[model samples]
Target: MYWIKLSKIYFHGFVAAMGVIAVQGCVLSTDLPDYKATLPKMADSWSSQLEYEVERSSIVSVSQTWFTPDFHQRISGFIVEGIKNNPELKSARARLEQQIAQYEVSESAFFPKIDLSGDGSRTKSSSKGPDGERIKSYENSFKAEARISWEIDVWGRLESESQASYSSLLQRQRDVEFAQLSVATRIVLQWIELIALEKQLDIARQEKSNLTEIVERTQDRYQQGVGSILDLRLVETDLANADSTLTSKVNEHSQAVRKLELILGRYPSGKIQSAKEFPKIVTDFSAGIPSDLLVNRPDLLIAEQKVIAAHHNLNAAKANRLPRLSLTQSTSYQNRKLSDLFDPYSLVTSIAGNIIQPLYDGGQRRAVVAQNKAIEDETIAEYVNTALKAFDEVENYLGNEIHLKKQEEELSRAALMAEQGQNLSRQKYYSGLIPILDLLQAQQRFFVSKSRLINIQKQRLLSRVNLYLALGGHNTPLQKIMQTDPEFSEDNRNL
Candidate 1:
């Protein structure tokens, strides 16, 4: 009786402690970590990262422009269609489906299990008296019953296992989200690269055409009495240079086409057309604060979920060593004949209590417990590291944007002056005021400066895209609101 009283008191204490722990779970994580808080400020304020914020854009609303129906191409839906067709994401989603099925296997233990059973036998027996000959007898019997068993989950052991399984399922769902996000980001970047290459091809073709005209004029001058043999040689040199540049651009343009086709999940053939202009990029991305980033990023959320699952696993391992209490019961009917198998006249009932404690296992259970704990610790460390790395990316982009903006302004002025200089030199040469070398020098400088300007513009646009992605909103208004508010108010951010 005294021992019974002690056991009751012990269980009560445990239940009380668990209730306290459940409440603490909510309160302990209210504050964001230092690294998470510093990200937005490091990237500059809301206006700083808002370089590409287009006025007509809506973060939540989809524009009809992104999914216009083409008569020839069956493609529709920018991201949704991309995710549907993406093989990696499809594979991940299939895996998640498989994992969701596994949860059923673990959950089955929580409910009663039933088994049908039967037994039949025929026996020959011999009996003998102390002084008499042995006598023989025959006996036959048949019995059938339905057996049922259930392990009553006490001490939350079964609940803990279910929680662990749920965590695993959740982790896989996040993996699916991660895969989708990855494919979407790749498609966007590859598409952007393809467009940039097309523009470059145009630049190359334009330069070649201009150079051809210059070469032709020089040839006409050389053929006249006033021009030298050196002038004719210079024309030949310029023509060859233009051909070489055009060849390089053609090769690059071909490569970009192949890459874009591959991103759409197609096999690359030599066929390519620069006919399609790129979709207007989303410039205005409102990236929320650093803490908000943690919620928006699928990769980080998946990582955190994995750590949470590992934590549950470690707890499960620890629980395994404790004595588990379960109640098993079965009610059935037995009969000597098949017809009587269901008759309640021969009903039988049994209830059993099981107390299982791990006495010895060659330290295997202990090792498992220790290993799981170590794994949980490592995951926690990794979660912290990933969070820090995200912070660095946001900060780097912010700093780059500020500096690149200034550089773009200066380079624009430089390109304009170079253009003017090139025009003047061309006019002077026609009047024989400048030598062929002076015009060639000016010609090279003018194109090079113009190319540099184009290159910088491309970089700035790419920076906007990358910054938007890294900040986790991809040129959406929710991102800006998150940045300005620094609080994750967007309903979609969590998901």
Candidate 2:
């Protein structure tokens, strides 16, 4: 009979709770908007085609064209070392991991939360009976209970939040990849700069030696009464200039080494070895279509992911302006006797449902929706800008490759002619056919042309590196270029 009565009471409580939920459901209304239609669309292709040409051709492959075998090996090693040790890349990876954890946290909202609790209490009371007699009472109670609660996502609020978090996780992952690419590109460029500086130092030393020899010869001619003191002074001044230039080049080379070492995550000891000469790279830059950049570039991909995340955020914000339903159930066993707490007769259970409809919040919910929409628009603009910038960079580097090659060729011819002229002028000065001023002019022109040619060569190599970076480091095109080059023999390895 007692068990029957307890069952009736529990059934009544459940019925009452259902009645309350049904009543509230009829009165509450949701104000959420359809957010899917608000998402922005992206372009399927580039706005413009890559129009730069090389060797009178509109299309070229840059992948291995400028990457010589030695350059490929050295830069590959540096990139590997830098990716392993760069602190900025490591930090980006750490942030990715954190976002992964946050994604899981957001996903947890889809499931119910359960809690277990237990408590024991003893109470004593003293009071006077109706007949003026003193009376005392003591009581002991023990209880154990399990409670479960869940927020029903009837309007897809939790689902939208989970999607947003997942997009954020993907964005963070792209950020890490972008960091890796950036670190590798920086290492390669710094390494190239250091090598070019070393070549400049060599050129300066050679020029210094040549000027010293010229000054000695002029002094000898002055002692023999064939050269004026003014002529000897002119040669001495040139020698001093060469010495000062050599000293500056040496300092620059040292600094370049230190910069490269820092990028490699090594101590800036300035002891790194560099190539003795600039690698002979191909003049042709193989730039495929501009559309390839959208798929290949990490930064662009990251921007796209941000837009996705923002779209999800906007959905979640719109969903927040609606009614939320939550259900909770608790069951407990209670008994004065501690061991009898687990008895079926002592059990009690109750269930409840709550619906929260925001009547007023001073327009906070509307502001949140507007803010997320604005953020989505901002990310879209940034993505479009990134794509345009990438295309501009590709065009700039391709044009640079063509113009730099022509400059290098013209300068090479000038350097050769200047060398021959300097030699002939020296011979003529010894034979008393030309003045010392003429010889000095020829020597100065030769040194300047040679120095300029070396610098142009270095610039060409640097431009190739920039093209590699702008193309998102895709190297298959480069391999094809390397295979077609006559200089790439069986012994030459691809970068």
How far is each candidate from the true structure, as Cα RMSD in Å?
A: 7.7, 7.6
lDDT of 1 by residue, 111-177 (tens): 9888887788778999996889898887666776666777766445566667778878888887865
Ten-residue region with minimum lDDT total, candidate 1: 63-72
For model 1, what is the error of residue 250's alpha carbon versus the real structure, in angstroms, after optimal superposition? Answer: 2.4
Clashing pairs in 2: 60-286, 61-286, 62-286, 63-478, 64-478
TM-score, prediction 2: 0.81
Tens digits of per-residue lDDT for model 2, 1-495: 999999999999978865765564443223333332333443453223233433456344555355667667666667666766788877887898899899999999999999999999999999999999989999999999999999998667788789879988888877876776677778767877777778778778888888788888889989999889999998899889888999999888888888877777889998988878777774454466677787888787887778777877887787687778899999999999898999999999999998787769999998998899899888888877887788788778777777888899999999999999999999999888999899989988998898899889878878877777788766643333333444432323311
Segments of candidate 2 deviating more than 4 angstroms: 1-66, 124-139, 283-285, 475-495
Worst lDDT run of 10 residues, candidate 2, spans 486-495
TM-score of each: 0.74, 0.81
